[model samples]
Target: MCKKGNEVDKDLHSLQLKNFMGLLVPHQRQIHAFILYLVVNRADADDILQETLVEMWNKFNEYKDGTNFVAWGLTIAKFKVLQFIQKSKNYRFHFDPQLLELLEHEAIRKNGVHTHNERVEILKECVSKLQTKEKVMLDLRYEKNLTFEGISRQFGVSVPAIYKALGRTHARLAQCIKLTLEQRGVA
Candidate 1:
């Protein structure tokens, strides 16, 4: 009976972790960007994101299952950022501690549990509705991760022409997305 109970407990923990991850994935980019805003160095920001993820995982049990995991994660990230700052006094950061705190609070306010899924839906629709040429350009630039020059070569166009097309496409997509979001009343 004791051994069976232990297995059940372990299984329950695993299930809870899966649930936590479902909640965590949506806000991951925002979390990393928050860390980057504080640390300012790409490498150091990446390290802090790793550390924050580990800490969040380790302390997963302390979290209430349906609560705001982004907020909780950001709290942990803030501490990690502070620790890094403390340890790296010799290193110069873009903002001092006070500025970081203000930025963190403001960022959290701006990005807190946004209409992420809705935005993704809107973006997909916008992309799909693109003119054929613009859609191909987007795929080349984004999906293939090609540079303007590379895209130009593939499309048999000048780099400047490619750049102009990409810019126009981006602006059109942005407008479409904004209109879609407004229609959805996501303000």
Candidate 2:
């Protein structure tokens, strides 16, 4: 009986490891690329990717077997992206229209098999030019998708303050985006 119990435990451990390795091994690059595309910076993407992987590992039990692994992993990645965006001070500065376009393209490509690598590259250039505060505000409003009330709660300010911040941030971002687009000959 003791021997049988030991064998069962060993087998379960092996199976769990195998499941984890299997999920991570094949999807790691894709997941990283998706994260990079969202965050538009190599370092931030790397951090978020690590966080996503850790989250996936911790929540592995919640994943249903024999399901779409990429989708599951991407879902986890999305959550991590949102978390990173919320916490990151640099996110506001890095919000590029090109990045936004690339993310949108990626969503469509997932269903139809296209690529937005060039768009992502362009986005990186655009994001690099934003003012620090503008970048942070953009990250808070758009990337994190925080509502005025939600943002107000975060800073313990009034909802109107959040709205004013967003308005000012948007104005700056819009100007930057327009200049970027014009320079790129897209406008």
Question: Best-fitting candidate, measured by lDDT?
Answer: 1
Q: How close is candidate 2 to the true structure, as a TM-score?
A: 0.51
Clashing pairs in 2: 92-135, 92-136, 93-135
lDDT of 1 by residue, 124-178 (tens): 9988989998988988888999988899889898999998998999899889987
Q: lDDT at 68 for candidate 2?
A: 82
Worst 10 residues of 2 by lDDT: 111-120
Candidate 1 residue-wise lDDT at 167 = 91
Q: How close is candidate 1 to the true structure, as a TM-score?
A: 0.63
Q: After superposition, how far is residue 59 of candidate 1 from its true place, in Å?
A: 2.5
C-alpha TM-score for every candidate: 0.63, 0.51
